[model samples]
Target: MEAAIAVLVAQFKAFAGADGSTDTLSKGEFQNLVTSQLPNLVKNSADPAVIEQLMSSLDQNDDGELTFLEFWQLVGRLANQHGGFSR
Candidate 1:
């Protein structure tokens, strides 16, 4: 579980920027990150053209980058869909 969390965090950081802090991302930056890193999930996203289209729906802030809560919500949803961690 810890390892999975770390991998998720690292992936988020990669998208979020070298600063790797959620606070550092602009809406555009966050969208780019999702497009590149979350291709599997976001490729089929309802609005595939702009990353912000999907992110804005999920983010709810219209501010762009996801807050930690938003990020965790995404991960949790995905994990539930995918059956979460395995032994």
Candidate 2:
């Protein structure tokens, strides 16, 4: 469990800087993160429209970028679906 958390943090940090900021993910960064790291979980992730909609849905603050907390929403949702978060 600790390792999984570390991986998630590492991945977020890895892609959060693609556009400039080290604290958040730009739209392109989020898209890259999802498509590359979450291919099986995020269907049609390569599509711009799909990425736009996902960004809209997850960017709760309307800040145009996703902070770690915003990014975690997707992770938590997926984990819940697979029973990884309900133990």
Candidate 3:
């Protein structure tokens, strides 16, 4: 469990805010992370429209970026669905 959390955090930091901020994920970063890291969970992740729509839905504050909380929530949902963690 601890390892999982660490890995997530590391990956988040690795992909967050290419312009320098380590606290949030820009749309491009989010798209890259999803398509590259979560290929099985996110089908057609390379599709810009799909990523944009998904990002729009996840951007709760409509800030055009995702904080770790938002990104974590999306991962949790996808994990439940794709990784069968819900079961």
Better of 1 and 2 by TM-score: 2
lDDT string for model 1 (1-87, tens) is: 899878877767666675546554556666666666666765554354555565665786656567756777666765576674533
TM-scores, all candidates, are: 0.61, 0.89, 0.91
- The order by descending TM-score is 3, 2, 1
Lowest lDDT 10-mer window, candidate 3? 78-87
State the local distance difference test value for candidate 2. 0.90
Tell me the TM-score of model 2: 0.89
Off by over 4 Å in 3: 83-87
**Cα lDDT tens digits for candidate 2, 1-87:** 999999999889989977667799999899999999988888899999999999999899999999999999989887796776666
| Candidate 1 residue 2 C-alpha distance from true site, Å | 0.2
Regions of candidate 1 where Cα sits further than 4 Å from its true position:
18-24, 45-50, 84-87
Candidate 2: worst 10 consecutive residues by lDDT? 78-87
Clashes of 3: 0
Residue-pair clashes per prediction, in order, are 0, 0, 0
* Whole-structure CA lDDT of model 3: 0.91
